[model samples]
Target: MFEQFTQDARQTVVLAQSAARRLGHHYIGTEHLLLGLLSQPHTLAARLLVVRGLDLAYAETTVLRLLGTPGLDARDADALGTIGIDLSAIKEKVEATFGRGALDRDPAHTRAGRFAGGGHIPFTKRAKKVLELSLREALRLKHKHIADGHLLLGLLREGEGLAAKVLAEAGIDFAQLRADLDRDIPAVPA
Candidate 1:
């Protein structure tokens, strides 16, 4: 929901959409969101992810490998589709977590026209759903800042989503990751 998102959250969504388009992906997978988080120049999400040792470049490489496309250049958008990523699987996970109703009511659509500076990349249904779930979770926790951790948690709750599966394939256990987050997240300043 773009309306409910703080500026940072909105930026993350925009970044995710851009990453999806740049990668020529029909659906915006969690990996795209991860890329989005990393793309931000300076944000808490970016910092936290780096501090936690999640290497964006390495992860991107792994993602490309998982897609069956290795050593593809970033400029080769044409080569992206051949990677064979499971879009349906990622979409199914997003839908299962946010539900169809909430997703359909995504506020990003209302604010679509607002983003005009760097070009507008439309969000796919799955991306919108993932953003919605992430925003809602942030709101639920009374968090004023929507960081990468929130996005990661949203993916985890998606219950074996593409991002979660990717993390697993990388030997990063979700349970352990969550445990680390729990142990590491500093209390929000009052």
Candidate 2:
């Protein structure tokens, strides 16, 4: 399936892995893929996303805010907040005492999924589905290869991943974004 990916599409996948690592996440999810798309500022996906206020920095912050650092979850914070416990403040003090990344869970201690070896983070099922949908999107559009735009289309179509959540948070209209992409996708075959 990757054989049909254009260089830009391949780069997006690589960037997704980088995003996951940078976020201290053990698995590559749709949120990381969305950050990957935004990282490539020159790509059609990035351009469109930026126009809608979903730049890489904003996306990265949103992903971290929602997903939290490794070993932590945003929901945990919310739960703590309800109980008058400030997780963020506690984390800050803990990290200050033990150095940064002290709260991060060791990979070996976490559930082992499909590790790609050499510290390669595995993709979440939904992320893999996004890639598959990218192929389907290319075929649907009568294109020969998958491109970054197709990846974005796939993310939007998936609609249940964290990437979609970020889009929703930004108030981006899925149908309008897809229509805009469809209007512009033909100009670039890759």
Candidate 3:
């Protein structure tokens, strides 16, 4: 599958991991993939996103806000709120007991064996799905090679991940973007 990836597409995948690590995230999610694509200026994905008003700085800020410092997902906190758990109180107690940076270590580092190492950041299930779907999208388009736009297409179709959520929060028109991507990029001629 990787063999079918264009150079920029391959770089996007590599950069996704770096993006996750830079953001102190334990897993590489679809949001990181979006960041990865945005980080590089040379790809078709980057060009289209920029032209459509997807600002990298703004996107990064939104992601970080949504993520909210390592160890706590804003969604999880909201969910816990429904049960009156008081995550903020818990956080205060934990910090008081263990001092700062107590839960700072990324969970990826604590996983056994293949995921045990500090430097190894694995893709979340959804991110992995995006890559798989990218291949499927390229094949469906009758293209032998996968490109960045195909990856972006996969990201859109995945639909339920953080990437999609972030895109929505940033006011990106996913339906229109998808249509533009599907129409503007042509499959390689057979």
Clash pairs detected, candidate 1: 67-83
Which parts of model 3 have CA positions greater than 4 angstroms off?
70-103, 107-119
Top-scoring candidate (lDDT): 2
Clash statistics: count for each candidate: 1, 0, 0
Better of 1 and 2 by TM-score: 2
Off by over 4 Å in 2: 69-102, 107-117, 187-190
What's the residue-level lDDT of 54 in candidate 2?
Answer: 82
lDDT for each residue of candidate 1 in 77-141, tens digit (9 for 90 to 100): 44544586554454458657754222233256435623322345565555556666766656667
Ranking by TM-score: 2, 3, 1
Is candidate 2 or 3 superior in lDDT? 2
- Candidate 1 stretches with Cα past 4 Å from truth are 69-125, 144-147, 179-190
How close to the true structure is residue 61 of candidate 3, measured as C-alpha lDDT?
Answer: 85
Model 3 residue pairs with clashes: none
lDDT of 3: 0.80
